[model samples]
Target: MRDEALPTVTAICRALIEQIDSGLLPAAGKLPAERRLSELFDTTRITLREALTQLEAQGLIYREERRGWFVSPPRLLYNPLVRSHFHEMVAGQNRVPATEVISARQVPASPAICAHLELPALSSVYQIRRARRVDGRLVLYVEHYLNPAYFPGILDCDLRQSLTDLYASRYDIRYGRVRFDMVPTALHGEAAAALRVAEGSPALRITRINRDQHGRIIDCDLEFWRHDAIHVSVEVPD
Candidate 1:
């Protein structure tokens, strides 16, 4: 008994889903441009876009700024309690993982970063910006601020590799106790640009404050992840 008007948004959504389910719009495949899709659906661009957005919110599709819409890939599982880094965890899940250092430099710590690292005003820190990919899909952009005092000459190290390994091998330091904070956020500025997503796209911001074996704050990480790209699960031991 459920029916919609001809060329309705719901009908458009259903048609798109059927196409996806039938392999017409394959996973990770870019959809037709909005103009083409709108013409095919015999609907206004606004209506077609609304349907597209609805599907995006359902995790059926996604759009990258200047890149257009695409079928979403399988979501990855993320556990905050795990000590594994992005590369390890992603590979463990049988997916390819990649990280590229976008920018790295010694900079004065802002008040927020200073508080996170317990540093004095304008203290110098190693600011490393990075973008990480899973299965060749850009999913996360992170900023790592390290206390330069603990890591002399770190700017010269190969930063594309995992910092977890770098710290252990080079500095003989290990991550001891760590604190995590997460909040729903919108992508903006460099983060959005790095991920190639529209500004204000739904995202998750995860802040990690890491401590060394001596219980000194070693560094902090700001991770911006696509909301639909991860399913966060945690296991608690009794």
Candidate 2:
């Protein structure tokens, strides 16, 4: 009787994927706890975990560490050529967007930071750290290092709002030329903690260097996106 209930690891993964594809497990919906899942799949907890881990690697599911696994949502389509900011872009795609300012202050730029904005080492810059959400799930963690010379007293404004919009309205600054660098990498330290995932989790890192309307370098951004949460969609002119 006991042996009859057990299923192979592949069988368990197949069962879960079938459920997910059939919409039985809705996107962003948390899967049952390990014990419950083991029973549901009629497999050992270890076997069940292996199946779940495979699903995670496939981007079919995501685990928020202690929060358990959730069905992965549709990836956010991102087009670098578009000028829309985070809030605007998410809204345009019919997804709810939110930003939380984690920390904001003037800090001495490190060598790497200085190099990105072409500033001297130890130059004072505004470092703004933020955790952003889509559909109520934390998906992006970004740090914005802004040259204070361009926008004075910017830290006093609402950091949760789109910096692009803020720059234009307050300092008459707008994007002129932008540079983008991206790579698939592993999450660590602050980025992993911000997204509630384990260190070494798969991630997408995007680095952007922004020059303002006057062609002056104004800021540099480091963005870490959950691997399953976004996909690039570039639109080139004919």
Candidate 3:
């Protein structure tokens, strides 16, 4: 690598990230060709590849086999045994947890919501939105859906605390199992605003479906966090 051109790769990477921040490089959009990028940055292919590799490792880009690299989407993982509240999770890690309730209301269940909760189509559902924070750093935007019949006075509960614990103690309901799925998503305008991050910024998308010992679904939650704030570890049994 030429000493003078070495800095160019870093500079170009920074510029590309800036474009992403500015919404110029939209999510799921393929980046310009490597040759084109090199030409634009006035650098060699080697330097460009180095920069792309670094970004790829940072979870910013994905290199398809035989295909070119494109901006990578976000991913989040939830642990069933980590039965702590959002606040508790952060606190245990020596961080802080803050919540800003975005909205709370009751509405008719949609088809998707009805199927998930095994409820009637017109069943009422309570939706709560809260922006989550840790150590004063914004982390995620959470949306929770509960069967209104199950939590008649949910809004009156101490929302700043662990909702699961509250349900277990107050309603005698316990979640014996939790199923979650991770998916790639772009930051919608409203979610981005709540998270205090730019729209389309890399974010981890998590859907948590909770169930009791009887295998009845309790609640469905959607969480969006900054991609960099979380690390997921998986262990395979011997």
Please give, for residues 112-199, the per-residue lDDT of candidate 3 as tens digits. 7787788986897898888877655556888889987677798877676678888888888888788878877887887888866557
TM-score of 1: 0.94
lDDT of 2 by residue, 1-238 (tens): 2444335767888888999999999998999999999898677887788788888999999999788989999999999999989999999999999999999999999999999999976698999999999999999999999999988999999999999999999998999999999999999889999989999999999999999888999999999999999989997999
Q: For model 1, what is the error of residue 162's alpha carbon versus the real structure, in angstroms, after optimal superposition?
A: 0.1
Which stretches in model 2 have alpha-carbon errors above 4 Å?
Answer: 1-7
Q: Estimate each model's TM-score.
A: 0.94, 0.95, 0.68
Superposing all C-alpha atoms, what RMSD in Å does each candidate have to the true structure? 2.8, 3.0, 9.7
Model 1: lDDT to the true structure: 0.92
Q: Which residue pairs show backbone clashes in model 2? A: none
Clashes of each: 0, 0, 1
Model 1: weakest 10-residue lDDT segment is: 1-10
Model 2 per-residue lDDT at 17: 91
Q: Candidate 3: give the clashing pairs.
A: 96-135
lDDT of 1 by residue, 1-238 (tens): 1134334888999999999999998989999999999899887887888899899989899998888999998899999888898899999999999999999999889999999999988698999999999999999999999999889988999999999999999999999999999999999889999999888998999999999999999999999999889999998999
